[model samples]
Target: MNIVILGAGEVGYHIASRLATEGNDVCVVDQDSERLQVIADAMDVRTVCGKASYPAVLKQAGAAHADLLIAVTTNDEVNMLACQVAHSLFKVPTKLARVREQDYVRHPELFGRDDLPIDKMISPEGEAAKVVMGRLNVSSAQDAREFFNGAIELVEVTVRPKGKLAGLALKELPDVMGELAVYVVAHEHNNRWRVPKGDTVLLAGDSIYVTVEKKHLDRLMKTIDLAYQTPEGRNVMMIGGGRIGYLVAKELEQAGAKVKIIEFNAERAEWLSEHLNNVVVIYGDALDRKLLEEENIDRMDDFLALTNDDENNILGSLIAKRYGVGHVVTLVNKAIYMQLMRQIGLDVTVSPRLSTVATILSHIRKGRIHGMASLADGQLEVLEAEALATSSILDIPLKDLKLPGDTVVGAIMRGNEIIIPNGSVAVKTGDHVLMVTTGESVPEVEKLFAVHLEFF
Candidate 1:
């Protein structure tokens, strides 16, 4: 596919990297030569240095023959204008843009095909809030992803030393749980990632990934880890009161949890207090331990370090961890620092920038991909798609199905019934299939599912 990307910032960089990895013909445009050079040297992508909204720049980026145009410049007007120019002059079939300003976000009706021409409007703050809340639902999980409109959830939990699951084999899980449904999709032991077979054994320090029906999520969490507990009217505190923080805090308040938000900027703090009726808005720097102590950090059931600065978020989350907070989630913008966070005991970190990247990719994927998630640092992806009648894998039992060695079917949903698939389970037409696969195996998975029909 010929794709043109506007802006070479964090989101654009990751998008180009992923699309290029998938062997797409991608061209990136940005005003910053240094940023363009950085991505150009790192990935197999064309880079154009100029004003992205200019028709000449779009033409230079191959927008005339491009399959899609993505505008993610920092300025919302520039992004919108780039899309309009791409549509008016280049006739690009698909246009996606990032619009984050509250004024623009509050009025989504401002975008339309006739006027704005933006096929999809990406909101990093909104996606980040959803990611944060999903993690909170599975507090003991390393991370969690929802699919099929939240009918199924995928969670990863590290096997703690001496935990009940540390010594069990993969095949024993179903028997141990009696009639409850659960499926072990993959495991990450040491640095190796693979689909776990029946003989695969669980060991301490190994990351185990599983999928279960949403109704049985809590039961599965507790069964996998003896120490797992549900959050009950808990105190949830956030260190940043920015847009992302406000969205998360508002959801937390509506969930009936005690919520508090601390903002470094006095004006924003005042605004948050006036807007959020239930949340306690504090005006203080999160880096000050004295302020956190005065707020009774130890009593917080969940501590969110949502500041924009990666260093401060990391340090603040570490402090919350040291205080024995039940769950410590930090907002890390840079992908480089996120891997370090999990290794240093902060298991969950949200990247709004990368979250927006996933949103864009999901919009670009050719199959009827309901949703997609990157796991194991983008090496692996969980994709949910509908099974077509002509799909090669249908009617054949999974045991005899020829799937990529790096792929595993996590769950299947037929109407309202959720199936934790096994070797004998066969997929039916129109069933929503949730599968996890490596980056290289994605194309093969799509081919096998007969989801080759075009989708924007």
Candidate 2:
């Protein structure tokens, strides 16, 4: 696919790198020649040094024949303008714009916004807020990825000794839980991803990736001893109330979470207090250890640092971890720092921009997958989709059907039960199926399912 990216920042960089690495014809546009040169040297793609909002600059970046154009600049105005130029001027098939401003996000039609020139809009701050909400609701989970149209959620939890699953072998999991794909994607013991086989055994402290219906999330947590006694405690402490922090705090407070927003600016803090309710606004620098300690940060069940500065969020989250905070989620927009943080053992890293862009790309690549998630650094794509009626899988028992070696059907919901079936299992009409496959086999995997299911 011919793709054009209009930003040189962290979000754009990560998207461009991933897309280019996946063998797409990628071109990047930015005003900074130094950043362009760095990206050019790193990835095999064209780099144009000019303002992306300009038509001539976009033309120079080859937007006319591009299959998709993504504008992810930090500036919301530039992103919108770039999308408009791509869609209205160049007629690019798909246009995506990054909108971080709270006003634009809440009401895109306001302020003379274009009348739907862009195909899609992404808000990294809003995306980060959703992640924070998921973590807060699912107390034991360090991270959560929802799929199957929100019917099921893939949750990441660390195994502890108190649970029935702590020392159990992989083969025994199904007997204990009764039909669930509790795959071990990554293990903290050796700090590497494990390609699961039946014989693999789980140990305490191992990071386990399991899939369960939203209704079953509690039951799954009970197996791991991570379910919260009072799920109603939704109070959240947000440090560095910047774009991400403001969005997250606002969403949480609106959803009945008592949000306490700490901002360095007195004016911003005052503004938030006046505009937001059920919120305890504080004016103080999050980097000041004394101020943070005074706020009783240790008492907060969940702590999130959403400052633009990656170092501040990382350092602050680390400190909060030491204070026995149950969940610590930080937003690191920069890809380089995120890699470093993960290597140093940061449990959960949220990049709204990257996650949003990848989501858009998944839809573009395979029309069948409306929602997709990549586990293990994009090596695997877990997709929720339907099968074609005339496809090879129709009227065939699932267990007897031959599937691609790289792909596995994680779950199929015929009427309920969220059936985790074996090879002899057969899929019926009107059934929703979830499959996990590497990127290369996505197309083939899609062909097996009958086409009666809605493609999104």
Candidate 3:
């Protein structure tokens, strides 16, 4: 695919590099000559130094022959205008834009007025909110993903010996979870991907990614001794009035959870109070222990440190943990900081860059794959895939079908319900299956489920 990206910022650069890595022709445009040179030198994409809203820049970047044109400039107006010009002049088939403002996203039609040309819009703030909610709903999961229009979910859970599943073997699992097929994609013990043998045993403190069929989700959870049911409304404290805080509070409020927001800027606090009637906004520095205590942070169910300052957010979350908050989540932008923070105390970390990368991969691999996520430091991937009509293993009983041990078929969502299958369970056409596999097992899984005959 020939693609043109407008913007050379973190999001744009990451998207362009990823698409280029997938063998697509990518061209990036930016107004800064220095940034353009950096992108040109590092990535395989072509770079043009000019304003994206200008027709000459679009022509210079080969937007007319582009399959997709992505407008991701920092300015929302620039992105919107670039999309409109590309659509009208270049006739690009797929036009996607990145929007940041809360009001525009809250009511897209207000700005989607007939003039703006765009097929879809991606909001990093909105995506961050979804990621936070996914963790909140599944208390046992370090990460959560929704797929196939919310039909199924993939959750990453740490195996602890205190639970009932502490001493279970691969062969014994089928006896306990007769209806569910369990695959252990990656294990931290040996630090490498290995196909599971029947004698393989699960140990405590091992992180494993699992897939649950939406219909049989309850049974699968019961067998694994995990609390699969959604958590009841819990008190959540947010430390920011920025876009991420607003969206996260909105999601929590909609889920019936009590939400409180703290902002250092009085003007932003007032705006949040006016815009979000459900959230209690307090104008105060979140870094102050006194202010956090005054807001009853000690009694909150969860604390999210989302302030722009990385150090402040990290310190605030640690303070909340010391005060006995059940869960402490912090947003860290730097990849290296994530490892350091996770090691110190924070249970989970959210990255906008990681979310953007996952989204772009999904868009580029949309044919056979529903989506892909890199987990446990790129060692494992929770992949959602669609089976083609003539796929090799179509309509075969899962037990009789041979599959790599490292890959597990988590769940099958046929329509509205989730199915946790067993040996007798047969995979039919049009059923979306979630698989947990390591990098090594991906090829075997794909070959087993190949939709078309191999020509080479």
Predicted structure with the largest lDDT when compared to the true one = 1
- Tens-digit lDDT track for model 3 on 256-334? 8888998999999998999887788999988788888788988998888887778888888888989998777888776
lDDT of 2 at 180: 40
RMSD of 2: 3.5
lDDT scores of the candidates, listed in order? 0.86, 0.72, 0.74
TM-score: the better of candidates 1 and 3: 1
Between candidates 1 and 2, name the one with more favorable lDDT. Answer: 1
Give the runs in model 2 whose Cα sits over 4 Å from its true position. 110-116, 161-163, 178-189, 229-231, 340-345, 363-366, 376-379, 392-406, 415-417, 428-430, 439-456
Q: lDDT per residue, candidate 2, 59-86, as tens digits?
A: 9999889888888877889888888788
The 10-residue segment of model 3 with minimum total lDDT is 447-456
Tens digits of lDDT, candidate 1, 163-245 = 87878898887677878888888898875778889999999888888898888887776675644444448898899998899
Q: Which ten residues in a row have the lowest lDDT in candidate 1?
A: 223-232
Error of 2 at 147 (Å): 2.3
TM-score of 3: 0.83
Give the top-scoring candidate (TM-score): 1
TM-score of 2: 0.87
